[model samples]
Target chain A: MYRQKYLFLLPGLLVLVAIILFPLLFTIRVSFSSWDVYNPGLNWIGGENYGRLWEDARYWQALGRLTLLSVTTVLIQYVLGFALALMVWRDLAARRLFRVLFLIPMMTTPVVMSVLWRTIFHESLGPLNPILESLGIGAAPWLSSAGWAFAAVVMVEVWQWTPFMFLLLLAGLLSLPNEPYLAAKIDGAGPVRTFFSVTFPMLGAISVGAILIRLIEASKIMETVYVLTSGGPGTSTETSSYYIYIRGMRDFQIGYSAALSLTYLIIMIVALTVIAKLLVRALVKDAA
Target chain B: MLKITDLELLVGSVAHLAAINASFQPGTLTTILGRTGAGKTTLMRAIAGLIAPDRGQILLDGTGWTRLPPWKRPVAMVTQQFINYPHLNVRDNVAFPLVRAGVAKADAAARAEAALARVGLAAMVDRRPSALSGGQQQRVAIARALVKKAPVLLLDEPFVNLDYNLREAFRKDLVDLLAVETGTVVLYASTDPREALQMGDQIVLLADGRIVQSGSPRDVFANPASLTAASVVNDPPINPIPFHQNGVADFGALGQQAITLPSGAYTLGLRASDIRAGGPHQARVTLTEVTGSETLTHLSLNGLDLVMQEKSVVLRSPGDVVGVHLDLHKGLVFGADGQRAGV
Candidate 1:
């Protein structure tokens, strides 16, 4: 029976090797060698590309910005998403309608959403400036200024992805055993007390899982920054992925880009691994 | 006293409860007996202030409780599903109510320990609910309710999820614990008649959203007001046969004794134990079920079927004719409307 199961898995294993392992091995090979389209030659350069990457200021800046973006966006998304999920989950009226409405932003393609937001944040022609002017606020550069550009990119990203967090957290909230809430109520616990004591603790594993997933996705954020800012205004909104794109596609430095990409991949793996460990610890603690 | 007067609740165009009136005294365990979908839980939830009744009111010691929310009421509930905070240990789970009530940590811990010890769960105070057995989890739930010191405790089939042996053991422990809880009005709901008889000081029988009868368990058992109430409290089911008068009370082959009853169409309710075997009246044995300690012999006579409880050592089989005698004095007589008629 075990051998039959293994035989059944052979086709899936072959597909995984072809689609995942092959490219991963190729990327590692390319990261070690000085290979570019212009040279059309593969010359092994040991760790020179990686050594240069350590001294690269722009690369370090992009990494810092990516970290900042991931942390800030994930935090904001979690708070807003959790609040929205609580609202719809608690409301008995029009709950389904509100849930569907809240999921619309996530349903739209991210690149298309970014393009749509680009027009909305247009400095002079956008509707947002006119609305702000109507509200007695002066017109400010939304996508032109360095700080405002970064804020605008973060806003778009948060707006588009917060719904994913909402969906996940809402499902977690719904699947929670209802008896505890009733017990809390009969125990004379107020709403806030029940939330902290009963709701929050019960949602531990789900919250960690949601944060981990959102962290991984938000770390690789590129399309919104690319479409809206294109790393413009002195690289203020450039992320690691955008920087890698610039090095490989624009500068034709494939070897250096591959090394940067590999290092970024390693950082993501480590971060995700830590998050997984935390999740396991939480679940084990719950069991214990 | 907790007085429920003319309580009516509508659940999505269906009447869940209608004109339920009962007064529960302090220091008493009132068991609500009903079948599934019989609105037993609805009545308990109304008393807990978890759900609002559409009409009527619940008053505790002359104060109206219909408008109060569950959190404001001095009530605690243990549901059938043993609901424990999976992330918290037994101590914290039991102490949560005290902490929420703004008690000091040291005081809450002490009280939680006392309550856990009351439920025999003090040894497992540091273990999470997931680590404990189902019975232990329910004990934690009970301890959580007990620590709240709520005057009104609602237990909705608290031991329905446990195994038979565990249920029996926990039932005894619960009875002993509640016996000392003076001034607490506990309302327990169960579909099991034997459980109600075992745990209830007072029994309220419900059927189809209305109270069929309410009295002491022995009184309700000895003299059920209606056929529904009789069935609600009878195990192995009461054998009901249509009774007709022809110048004398005739109960088919289960021969009836002399009794003065009014001339009208009625039904007779006989408990299995009241039907005596080995008499002049004859009934063909159709089936014999042998339990460890007792045997339930199913018999049929003149198109009426009846069951008789005998010792397990008795030898009986299908298609055998046997003499049966029904002790009519121990049976109940119901009118055409299924209400117990006066003799």
Candidate 2:
């Protein structure tokens, strides 16, 4: 029976090995070798690509930008999402309709959303500039200036993904045990006090989980930047993934890009592990 | 006094509470007795100011409290589920209300400790609610309410979630705790008649969102005004048999002995304890359940099912013929409208 059960899992195991394990091992192998699309030959470089990545100023800048984008976007998204979720969770007329309307942005394709936002942020002929101009503020070169371009990319990322956080946090809010809230009310705690004392504490684990997921996804952000700015105006918004794409596909430095990708993977693993530990500690502390 | 006059509450389209009128005296523990969905919780919520009544006035000491918010009301409620702030320890949980009331931290902590000691949970002050058992969590909730020191305490079936042994102990503890709570009217809602009889100084019987009866517990149990009141106040439920009158002061049942009631169609209600075994009337024992100290014998007499509780350790088997006697003087007679006829 055990042997038959093992046989039943054979096809799934083969697929996993083919799709996940093989590519991972190949990437690790190629990181140490000098291989380019034009050369068509693999040279045993033995850590040369890794050393080159460590010395590259543009690679470090891209890494820094990736960190800035992930942290800023996740933070802004969490605040805005929590506020929206709280508003929609209230007992109001057409609340369900508002919830559904808020989730539409998240349902749209990321690339398509990026294109739409790019048009909206157009410096010369966009609705955003006209609105700002009408408000007596001058039109901003949203997609042209380096600072504005980065801010634009972050805004698009936040706009597209904040709804996902809203949905998760809304579910967390709705499923919270009702008794504690009632207790708070009877105890004469006002709305603000109840939120800080009871609601926020109960939402700890879910908030941490949402932030972790958004952080992981944000760290790999390339599509929005690629569509909106394309790391233009002197590589201001070049995230690590876009930087790797530039090296591998645009510059044909496949081995160097592979090395950079491995380093990115390691950093993500360490960061996620640290965050998971902190969340577990928080949960355990709450339990205690 | 907490008085509700012409209280009408509508939950969506259905009338949850209709024309409810009752006045609860201060320093009395009034148990709202009813079955599930009998509007006991709704009444409690209305009194707590958690929900508004459609067309009624709730007065606390002659001041209208119907429009007041829950936080402004001088009331605290303990729900069926044990609700404690999971992240806060027992002391903090108990002190939360006081802290929110703008009491100083030291004063709140002192009062919280005193309340915990009152609930016999002072030793577990540092433990979180998750670390405590269900009974202990409820105690923490009670302590929280005690710390609030509200003039009115609404407990909505707070002991329903505990085990039988814990429930018994908690019931005693709750009774003792409320004993010394001067000037605070406690409204305890429960479906169990035994709990009402044990804990209530006054029992308010509700059925179909209407107040069927209200009086002292013993008086309400002994003379339930209607069939609904009798059914709500009886543990094993009152055995109601269809009674047909042949003539004046002559009724069917009791082996042809006529009851002294007017000639009419009626239903006779008898409590389990009032139906004795071994008398003149004969009945066949269908089932016998011995509960250590007493035996509950289910008997079929004249094609009517009757439950009799006896103290003797008699092992009456199924199909055994037993003489059943009913104390007719203690029996209840209900007319067509399910109300007691001729008092």
Candidate 3:
């Protein structure tokens, strides 16, 4: 007899299948077919789209670019976030106001934040270049030039996402016991030594967690690139997600985009798994 | 010698430590005896430089440590909670202080190892603090404190969290371990009076953020400065009775006694041991408790609650009337102001 108790799980199971499993299964099936604007039906063309994307230099180049952009941005975010979190963790005047102000960027919608950043990056008419010029630093082309444009994208990512890291690290800091700090103080450790010996090491597992979450979110960089650089002055700011968006939506290559997406998903899973192992080994002592 | 003069600390109008004047000579372990929330921790924290005193000075061998940060002060403290570094192993946890104080890692490790062995935790040196038992973790904390060998060692009820057997055993081990450090001026805080009397070279009685008495353990015990101090230092708690005097002091159902004194009002503090079974007066047993080999029986005599202690275990149920003898000579007497008075 079928257990009547399992009927209760059906609603939740159905929702999971509809929201998650179905799309993933459908995308996998669609990847093997050659579907496009003209060839709208799911006509089988086994592995042809995958074969083409493997040789496509643009896809690989975009993957490499995405890797550089996310890693650099996430690392910068981690450092800046940790510094900010520590600054407001204790004994600061107007601490609550500062905490709220620090989280404002993360609280904003990503597309809106990107648009605001894009306006700031406007070379001739923006507030940023004028301020930089006023500070005796020569103004470079922000959105027009490749290097500055990439920098601008990285800047936006860091400014918008650093709060997530800060929040996690600060929570970790708050939960820490007062005894270790007391012990450190009695041990005659200065502030810097205490940070390295006690605070930083104590926040290790949380650091890894914040970094991983940021990295995963950062790897799928789309809205900021779409608004600011549009992958360009010659594809310099084009990330993997943006490239996939173009292939799927702009050019209408459904089968090819599906293949690209599945590849990206698999690569992210494998890469993140390896990265997690390496990070846990380095940060957490028990894993070592 | 470590001296504290007129040290006062107020936490927003509540006096945490008020006018606390005390001193400790080298090698003497003075137990700051008090009940919980009696400013024992506040006083110790002030000495450790964790909290600043609002008034007066803390001088350790002519060095003013009132404004100095805890890290800059030459001190080591073990708290009531068994706190050890969660990230570090037992060995590293012990060696951390020495290493941070500019000692070489290898030298610190060797010393830490020796200290661990002294605390009977030699086998668990490589294990993390989380992996150890509560007693073991506390021993690690003690080992860490000892490894520092700082001149001023403040132990704030270090074995409070342990079980009875572990606490008893750890106290003996601590005494043995601490005996070797002859130059170290150790200050131990304990709420238990018996522990204070047993462990302290001297006892400083604290009540309501004030030092009620300070003397040798026997001196403090023999002459309690205040009724509050007397009651605090008594085990099974002292029975405090207020007497209305009119050439005779009221003793409730134990009967009034004519005393050679002229008094308006006075309080008599009596221990459970002062009341013996078999006498002219009778008290009804309200409750009976057997702790170890002794029996503590609660009684109601003429609408007054009293306690009688027996050396042997005797189970007397509720409503059972028993004849009790009042040992007046052993009972402590106090004035209306709670100050101890001569019988």
What DockQ, on C-alphas, does every prediction get? 0.63, 0.59, 0.66
Q: Which digits, one per residue and each the tens of the lDDT, describe model 2 over residues A7-91? A: 9889999999999999888888889888887764567889999999889999889989999999999999999999999999878
Best by TM-score: 3
Off by over 4 Å in 3: A2-55, B237-269, B302-305, B332-337, B340-343
Q: Higher DockQ: candidate 1 or 3?
A: 3
lDDT of 2: 0.88
Q: Chain B TM-score per candidate, please.
A: 0.91, 0.91, 0.95
Interface RMSD of each: 1.5, 1.4, 1.1
lDDT preference between candidates 1 and 2, better one: 2
For model 1, how does the per-residue alpha-carbon lDDT over A1-288 read when each residue is reduced to its tens digit?
A: 667878988999999999999988988888888877776456899999999999999998998999999989998999999899999988579999999999999989888998999999997888998999999997879888999998998898889989988999899999988878888888888788888777777777888889888999998888888889998778999999999999999898898899999999998899789867876676445644
Native-referenced DockQ of model 3:
0.66
**Candidates ranked, most accurate by TM-score first:** 3, 1, 2
lDDT of 1 at B224: 92
Fnat of candidate 1, please? 0.81
List all candidate RMSDs to the true structure.
Answer: 3.5, 3.9, 3.2
lDDT of each: 0.88, 0.88, 0.90
lDDT of 3 by residue, A149-194 (tens): 8999999999999999999999999998887888888778879999
